[model samples]
Target: MSEFGNLVDSIEIPLRWGDQDAYGHANNTVYFRFFEEARITWLDSVPMKTAPKGTGPIIIKTSATFLKELNYPATVQVRTYAGKAGNTSLESWYEIFDSKTGVKYAEGYAKIVWFDHETRKSTRLPDELRALAAE
Candidate 1:
């Protein structure tokens, strides 16, 4: 797993009206998008390796643990980090927090497996890639 020093990567997202649910807060599904945006942004900013051009990584498993509610007109700061690295997959963790208050509103994690474009099967993570992540 990569050791980052409280290195938070964030993006500003406006709560859409459609994002609301019966609970009167941003719908749970929207949080996934926020998490995705955060993770992509973080990856783009860092010197990290991505799954090759055509083939993309697939989520083997995913989970979310909601901590609190988020309302409309609020901007969320989504944060992401690489948590655990494995032979064929890596664990990614995320958190959505209030942009102003910095209070964590939701947290989630995903296990992504690399794949070969042509073979359409899962592949082991490259050793160099793992080492890069560890740094």
Candidate 2:
């Protein structure tokens, strides 16, 4: 919970050689992928009950701010924070830092809505998920 508090969940992602851009730093788009990994990992950690039918979390919007450049041969620690939760939507924040030096590389947030695949509409979040978000 450094700066972006309550996003205590974290995962480590190793930078690959191909992640680097022509300029030698990690591609900007790769940070979004890191955030995605953190978000999915965090959500997966929360135990939830079965949904009504074909229901799952879907990201409606996402954005990231580049703070520092990242290169290959490094590991990043991605941290996730679950923000406010509404009836069917919630916001998640993320931070990517050099695992060894603790230097921040990027930060981002995502708005997620619970959706029913079958009905093709937004649905209320499961109780378990809501509880997890509250934490």
Candidate 3:
């Protein structure tokens, strides 16, 4: 975890050419995409009775802090972590950096709420996820 929170999952994604902006660097929105990819991957890996269409996780908030410029032609890794778990919410954090040199490009987090699609309200987190966050 190394002070980033409990390690949940990580993934390496190649920077695509279209990821760059007119400034020749990765656009600000790219960081959010990286975080989203990692989060989705993690969610797919977990075992839970509810699905996104049923009762599942939804991001209530998300933010990122850019540290360095990211460019194309590089493979970057995003390290995901479970920060804090409330009764019906969890904080998911991420660190995106170059996979080769391990240079951190950005750090971000998303506040996820276990939500019911029909009721359109928050629900208690799944037991599997609660156990994961306890770790």
Candidate 4:
């Protein structure tokens, strides 16, 4: 198994009934939202001089793997870590695990490309972002 950085950030989300499928387990698509929360948590951890210039990395790809079932009446913890921060893109990994068991219920990764909003084109990640991710 690839050992990633320690728990960089986390978000607790309440389980909604609608989050479950007919089988009474959390729907597969809902895992993406959990991943989103983790990403936002990581972004929140990194203090910014400005609001990312509203033109930095943008989500380009995402994938999820389900390991176990999660149901309503349960609170989930989305743990986050930086997997690979590249020159033109970065990858973030997430684990939605039971807060008590620490057992991962689901996991996923997202790849994002840095973009120049003004030009509407992709660009290499800024040095400051690279440094922040290094930590």
lDDT of every predicted structure (CA atoms): 0.72, 0.86, 0.90, 0.77
- 2 or 3: which has the higher lDDT? 3
Off by over 4 Å in 1: 1-8, 45-53, 126-129, 132-135
Q: By summed lDDT, which 10 consecutive residues of candidate 1 come out lowest?
A: 1-10
lDDT of 3: 0.90
lDDT of 4 at 25: 92
lDDT of 3 by residue, 1-135 (tens): 557578989999999999999999999999999999999999999977766568988999999999999988899999999877899998899999899999999999899999998899998898888887834
Give candidate 4 misplaced runs (Cα > 4 Å).
51-53, 132-135
Point out where model 3 deviates above 4 Å: 51-53
lDDT ranking from best to worst? 3, 2, 4, 1
**Reference-based TM-score, model 4:** 0.85
The number of the candidate with the highest TM-score is: 3
**Residue-wise lDDT of candidate 2 within 82-115, one digit each (tens)?**
7778899887889899999999998898988999
lDDT of 4 by residue, 67-114 (tens): 989978788888887766787877778888877777789888888688
Backbone collision tally, model 4: 0
Local error of candidate 1 at residue 20 (angstroms): 0.9
TM-score of each: 0.79, 0.92, 0.94, 0.85
Reference-based TM-score, model 3: 0.94
Return the clash pairs for model 4, or none: none
Q: Score candidate 2 by lDDT.
A: 0.86
